[model samples]
Target: MFLISDMLVRIVPLCLYSHTGYYARFFTYNVIGGIAWVAVCVFGGFWFGNIPIVKNNFELVILIIIFVSVLPVVFHLFKRRSENKIITKPLAEVVEERAN
Candidate 1:
C-alpha cells in the first residue's frame, strides 16, 4: 500500500478538501484505517493460520491476499490511461471554449 500511497481512495478526499481544514479529517481516517488494517492482519493470521488446513495452504492464502490488494491499483492504471487520452482533446476546441 505504501508503494501506491500517492494513488488511493484516501488521496482523493485529502486533495479535494485540502483547503477546508481537511488535515484532521484525513489524518483521523488514515490513523483509524491503518490501525484496523494492522490489527486485522496481524491477529487474524496469528490465530487463523494455526489451523491445520490454513497452515498447509499458507502460501496460497498469501497469494490470494496479494492479488486482492494489487487488483485495485492495476485497474486504476488502466482507467487513468483512457482518461488521459480523453482529457487531451484538441488545441482548437480549447481555444473555442475560452472564446465562449
Candidate 2:
C-alpha cells in the first residue's frame, strides 16, 4: 500500500527533479524520507496496535485515522476552490459588463 501510494505520489516530482539535474539531492532526501516514514509507521503501529482500546475498536480507530488523514486534504481543496471563486468572480463580472 505504502509502496504503491508512494510511487504514485512521487513519480511526477521525481521525474521533474531528475530532469532538472537534482537527482542526487532528491535521491538523498527520498532515502531519508522513506526511512523515516517506515520507522514511524512501523513503530507507531506496533506501539498502538497493542492497545486495548485500539484492539477492541479497530474499525472505529481505522475510520478515525482515515478521517484525520483526509481532513487536511479536504480543507485545502475547499480553500483553493474558494480562493479561485473570489479571484474569478470580479473578473467575470467585469467581462460581462464589457460585453453588455
Candidate 3:
C-alpha cells in the first residue's frame, strides 16, 4: 500500500519508455493488487475482528489506521530530508533530472 503510490510516482514513467504498453500491464496488476488489498482488509477484518482481544480494542484499530496512513508520509519526508531533496519538487522535474 505504501509502496504502490510511491512506485507509480517515481517509476512509472521509466516503465513507459522501456516497455511496450506499460500502462496496460500496470492496470492489470493494479486491479489484482486492489482486489487483494480489499479482500485482506474486509475478510481479514471479519475473520479477526471476532477475536476477543482485537474486538475489544477499538482504539488499537484506530491507531493502526493512523500509523499505516501517516508513516508513509513521514518516511517520505525523512527520505527527502536525508537526501537534501525538496519534497514539493514536481515529479516531472525529478524524472527529468534523473534522466539526464
For 1-100, candidate 3 gives per-residue lDDT tens digits of: 8699999976876577458757777778778988999999999889888888888997898899899999989998998889995468889998999999
> Which rank order by TM-score, best down to worst?
2, 1, 3
Task: Decide which is better by TM-score, 2 or 3.
Answer: 2
- Native-referenced Cα lDDT, model 1: 0.86
Per-residue alpha-carbon lDDT of candidate 1 for residues 1-100, written as tens digits (9 for 90 to 100): 7758757765777776686878888788889999999999999879998899889998898899899999999999999987877547588998999999
Candidate 2 segments exceeding 4 Å error: 1-12, 66-100
Over the full model, what C-alpha lDDT does candidate 2 score relative to the true structure? 0.91
**Tens-digit per-residue lDDT, 1-100, candidate 2:** 7799989896988898889999999999999999999999999999999999999999999999899999998998999998876444677898988899
Error of 2 at 8 (Å): 10
Report how far off residue 30 is in candidate 1 (Å). Answer: 1.2
What's the C-alpha lDDT at position 11 in model 2?
93
Lowest lDDT 10-residue stretch of candidate 2: 83-92
Deviation in Å, model 3, residue 1 alpha carbon? 15
Q: Candidate 2 has what TM-score?
A: 0.48
